[model samples]
Target: MKKFIKKIVLFLSPCFLILCLIVVADPFKVWFNYDDYNSAVTQNGEHVRFKLFNNNKDKYHFDSFIFGSSRSHAYKTQEWKKHLKDSASPFLFCASSEGIYGILNKLKYLDNLNNPIKNVLLVLDEHCMRGNSNKKGHLYISTPALSNESSLEFYKTFVVASLNV
Candidate 1:
């Protein structure tokens, strides 16, 4: 029995060590606080944008938003702001591959937060209308705060993704 238990421990030790490393290293940046997120690794733009808005909302007092997918990046915030009222504080709230579901959820999130939504520029195309569901993969997944998903499940998704390759 002692020998059998020793073998089991040896077999499981590497798995335990890997998990520990995953928690400590946080290759996906999901487990730790970061000042500037590294752009080399394709991150979930939805999550990153949401976190950025939440962190600086009070200071910026952003009341206007431009929501869309990567294509919308061409719409400069300065140009968009020119169309809005003088008091509008505009923010670019875009995602990597945004769909209608993401856009609606982001709108709902802002409404729930009691933030004023004075102006909105939605740069939409056929792609944005094609999907109304949450995207898969760590880089495309919706943020928990926007999707109302379990935070544990969100973190688990990132952890599992980091282990896949």
Candidate 2:
């Protein structure tokens, strides 16, 4: 019994040590900053998703909400703010390229809010509708309402972001 216990400890000790080393390295911790602030970490990886929307309700109430894969994140809020031209109407671009399932997850959580999201721009890459075997016909369906009205742009930013992620 003592020999068996010794073998188990010897096997697990290296793995445990490697895990400790990786945590101490903190590789992604420094890459979490944008807009001169480390808000991405504080927003996505740390705080609960719904909490973010709820906390900022006063600022985003009756505003336009942008949703999409990582493609949407590439848009600079300052540039979009000017495009919107309505200073009082605040907008947020909450985007992720984790696939359609990810976007749906975020939308489902945010949809619970009482805020009036006048426009939801679904900046999608072609892959958002195709190669999505992960969710089984879930996020690929066409919305006729948005199809006729939404502006379609093939931005280079989304491609770069997709590669980075």
Compared with the true structure, all predictions reach lDDT values of 0.85, 0.44
Q: Whose TM-score is greatest here? A: 1
The ten-residue window of minimal lDDT in model 1 covers 26-35
Root-mean-square deviation per candidate? 2.4, 11.1
Question: What pairs collide in candidate 1?
Answer: none
Give the residue spans of candidate 1 off by over 4 A: 1-13
Q: Give the alpha carbon lDDT tens digit for every residue of 1-165 in model 2.
A: 999999999999987785555445423232222223333322232112223445566765636666665466676556666667474454444433335655565555545545555556567787666523222111222222212212122112222232344
lDDT of 1 at 140: 79
Clash count per candidate: 0, 3
Instruction: Work out the TM-score per prediction.
Output: 0.85, 0.50
Q: Where does model 2 exceed 4 Å of error?
A: 30-63, 83-98, 112-116, 131-165
